[model samples]
Target: MSITEQIRSLEELASVDAELKILEDQLNQERSTLDALRGSLQKLEDKLKTDRAHIAALDKTRSDLVAEVRQMNQQIEHSREKMNRSRNEREANAAQRELEELRKLLRDREEEIGKLTTEAEGARQGIEGTEGEASKISAELGSQEGDISSRLSEVESQKAKRVTDREVAAKKLPPVLYRRYEQIRSKRGTGIAQTSDGTCKACNMALPPQLFHRLRREPLLDQCPSCNRIIYFVSPAAAAQPVKEG
Candidate 1:
């Protein structure tokens, strides 16, 4: 094809691509809401796992504390028997001091067990609250997913049609030119921009007078120096061609 015809085909492809981009943005926006909910649910689940593990550790510590208390009680009982059977004042005083120390240690340990019991209870309640919240979100997701899925499905079908249209448009161009367009589009998100005057709309930089004049005078496919996108001129005569009534 001549350069003019190639430029026209590129222009057509660019138009289709612009529409495709809008659809793509819409898809991302829609998916983001669902993704955010899923992310929140995942965090809750992780917290529940951590809290349960903590509760289990607390229970183990409490059990060990209880065993220690039992041993302390046994020691206190033996000390009491020794005091009752003491032969003299010195022996009775020694047994009394030992009994006091053991009782104090027992009291401290029992207090710690109480605190642990409270902490474990708090963790259990937190797990219950987290579970409830997770259930609510799961239910919400189940309710919302049907509508979101249907909407996404419809958009995907539209997107697929445009993808086929893009393939058709791409096949019409020479391989080298198409490759160049794809490369530019990968970097700039667009491959071409039209100019009626000398201004590059993509970058908003005015083209040099000589460069703009050449593009207007010739059937050339040129790049905007500022943005490096395939640039073409829109002549007044061509722009003035009336749209036909369908």
Candidate 2:
């Protein structure tokens, strides 16, 4: 390619690189959001599983306590009836002692049942709250997943096209120039830069007056002294060309 043609190709390659970067950033951000949503959902599900297991254990304990308390009440009644029929003070006192023991055990069991009931209720309430949060996150994830997937597909498609464009642009340059451009892009994120008013815009440094004048008068492949980026001068007409066309 002629020097001017090669400059145009470099510009086109730069544009493609810029677009590709934007596409990559979009993809990363979207994927990160999707992963975070999935992670949150998984945590909530795990907590629900553990809480349900705890509530089940509490229920089993409460049931056993209730049954024991009922049996104790029956024993207390039996002791009272026996005391009523006792013929002497010794038998009556023995029945009274048995009744007191049964009542104390029943009281303790009832208190245990009460504490278990409170714990179970608290756990149930926590589950309800977690479920509500999970539901909200689920709905949001469902909606976001579809939208982000569509957007990611579109970005990938655009990136593919830009890649092809970059390849074509790269091929237009001489091999040496292409390799140099690639090296510069790898290190600096961009290979070429423009000059205006004797300054290398890439580095904000003044170009050599002799070099700047020559670049403006004739197209050439050159590098800025300060930044080492490929340098070009934008003639008034060239500057007016549409960016994509250039």
Candidate 3:
């Protein structure tokens, strides 16, 4: 291939490769997003499970407290009946003291039941709130599933087309030049670098005056001394042409 044809083929291949890279990057980002969404869903599910377990524990506590309160009530009633049956002053005094102690015990048990009831209510509310949030997240995830899948399919199709184009473009160059381009690309991610105003755009380094003159005079491929990337010069008119993909 002539020097100009070689540069054109390389440029076309580079363009396609760049596009393919973009598509691949997009695919990676989309996959990450899907993974993140699923992770969030898993977290919500775990939290919901924990909340349910907490509520169950609270309910058991409340039931135990209620049973204790009922027992205390029955004991206080029996103490009251014993006080009514007292005959002498000493017996009445003793019965009165006994009744006071039983009432105090009953009051303490009722207080505990009240506290547990409140705690159980709070736990119930927590379960409701968590369930609502999980539902919202589930809906949002469901909505994104179709869109992500469609975008992934489209990106894969585009990447396949670009790969084909790149193969065709690579075939146009001589074997030695193609191998050299691949070597540079492997190291630097881009093999071809355009030059502007005596500067290598890739490395942003100044080209030697002699080298720049040679590049302009000879129809040959040249490498940047600083970065070793294939260099090409574009005239003002040529640069103005609309860039097209091969």
Candidate 4:
């Protein structure tokens, strides 16, 4: 094939390959973002569940405290009723002293109920705080989910467009030039390089004067001795020629 045709073919192939690489990198990034978002969502869900369980336990504790307090009140009422029926009927000083002691016992139990009520109030406040925190976390997780979905969709669309562009550029090359370019790219990571001022751009090696002069004649495809890549001279006028069949 003509040198210019070879360069154009290789250039188009390189463009397509570069675009495909970028698309793959972007796809990987998008997938990573999705995975991280899902993980955060799962963590938030677990935290919410744990918070709810703790709140439920706190509620049960408060309820039990209230029931105990009610039971204490009932006992105090019964004791008072008994003391009234006795009506100072006990003539012994010891009996009067015993009734006073029972009254003191009821007073102590009342104080205990008051302490329990305060503790229950504290527990209720804690439950409220946990619920608020859980709600905030849930809302954050929802927003992340939506954001990740939107980002992934955008990446997918961009990737599709890049792939289409790559395909179109690949089709511009002749079949043989296209196949050779693909083979070299797969094996060496680059299929073509420019030879300018006696230097091979691919390897940055100064070509021998004999080789550099030979390339100027546009005889045939030339592989750089140093880098093993097809070398072409870039010229705007020569770039439009059709590739000659070998």
Candidate 5:
């Protein structure tokens, strides 16, 4: 391959590498979103469990109150029958007062039960809301997971193709040039750069006339002074040619 052809190959590699980077970023973003959603779902589940437990405890308390009130009523009824049989007027008066006090206690217990039932109902509503939020998070997480998988697959395939192309291009270059390209690629994430209209395409630096002329002749492989990237002159003709033609 001519010097211009090599430069063109490098440019193509850069383009592919750029695309690969974008896909990788997108894949990473999707994975991040999936992780965040998973955390949210976990929190929602924990909240639901706590709410359900609280509601269950309230229900148990309410049932106990109902049983206690029923026992109090039975005691009052037995006391009234006993008072009627004995004909002890003062004792009957004491029994009646005790029964009245028990009735008041029952009324208070009933009121507490009503309040507790309301609280339990509120807890149930909270649990339902948490469950619904968890479901939504699960669905969103599933979608993100699928997108990440698909994008990762595409990135891997594209990366493989880029590797193959890079290897092919390396074969066409001199050993010294290839080595220099590798060094620059490691440092700057790019192996080669084009010299365009007296400027380095990699760093957009205007080159000295002497350096520009040196690259135009394709002497030894050149590195850009500003960017440290391997610089080569791009032939207008080579740029116009298609990859298949090359």
Candidate 6:
């Protein structure tokens, strides 16, 4: 193929490569988001489990306290009956003291039960809040997964077609030229750059008059000295028209 035709083919391949890179980057970003969502959900689930365990422990403590309080109440009732049966003042006073001590123990146990009950309520609330958050995240993750899957399929299809096009374009060029194009693309992300009005479009550097003249006369691919990119000259008519930036 002629150098001009070869340049055109390289340009086509470069366009395809650019598109593929964009699709791949997008796919990676979506996958990363999916991973982050899953990680967050796992952490929330772990926290919920811990909170439930804490509540269970608190419930057991409360139950033990209740049983102790009941036992204390029974002891106080027996002490009261003993005081009623006491004949002497000294024995009656001793029975009263015993009853007071039993009552005190019962009060202390009840207070502990109240505290434990409050703590268990707090833990239950925490679990509810965490479950709500997890549900929200799970719904969002589901939607995102669907979108990513569809987008991935579309991107893969387009990428496959572009790969085929790139292969066909590469085959048209001489092996040496094709290799040079690949090397430049690897470094600069673009191999072929169009020039307009004596300026290298890729680097926006002004080309020397002599080099521009050579580019027009030589009919072979030329590299820009400043940027080392493959450069092509456009006709004045094309140059006069506004060119869109890539």
Best by TM-score: 1
What is candidate 5's lDDT per residue for 1-246, written digit by digit as tens? 666566656666666656666666776776677678888988898888888888889999999999998998898787777667656878888878877887889799989989998999888888888888889888888777777678778777876777777577657666776677677777787766666466776677888889898777763357778878877776655433221100
> TM-score for each prediction?
0.89, 0.70, 0.72, 0.49, 0.59, 0.69
Which pairs of residues clash in candidate 4, taking residues 3 or more apart in a chain or in different chains?
A: none
Candidate 5: stretches off by over 4 Å: 1-9, 29-43, 57-115, 136-159, 164-183, 235-246
Lowest lDDT 10-residue stretch of candidate 3: 237-246
Best by lDDT: 1
Stretches off by above 4 angstroms in model 2 are 60-112, 208-218, 236-246
On the 0 to 100 scale, the lDDT of residue 178 in model 6 is 81
Those runs of model 1 whose alpha carbons end farther than 4 Å from true positions after fitting are 236-246
RMSD of each: 4.4, 4.8, 4.5, 8.8, 6.3, 4.5
- Residue pairs whose backbone atoms clash in candidate 2: none
* Model 1 root-mean-square deviation: 4.4
The 0-to-1 C-alpha lDDT of every candidate, in the order given, reads 0.88, 0.86, 0.80, 0.66, 0.74, 0.82
How far residue 124's Cα lies from its native spot in candidate 5, in Å, is: 1.3
lDDT of 4 at 125: 70
Q: What's the lDDT of the predicted structure labeled candidate 1? A: 0.88
**Candidate 3, 75-143: lDDT as tens digits:** 778877877888888888887888788788778867877887788788778878878887887888899
Q: At residue 12, what lDDT does model 3 achieve?
A: 84
Clashing pairs in 6: none
Task: After superposing candidate 6 on the true structure, give the runs of residues whose Cα lies further than 4 Å from its correct spot.
Answer: 29-40, 60-113, 239-246
lDDT of 2 by residue, 1-246 (tens): 688788878888888887888888998998999999999999999999999999999999999999998899999999999999999999999999999999899899999999999999999999999999999999999989999999889988988988888888778888999899889878877788887578776777899999999898898879988878898998655452222211
* Model 1 lDDT per residue over 84-171, tens place: 9999999999999999999999999999999999999999999999999999998888888888888899999999999999999999
- Best of the two (1, 6) by lDDT: 1
Candidate 3: segments with Cα more than 4 A from true spot: 1-5, 75-109, 168-189, 220-228, 240-246
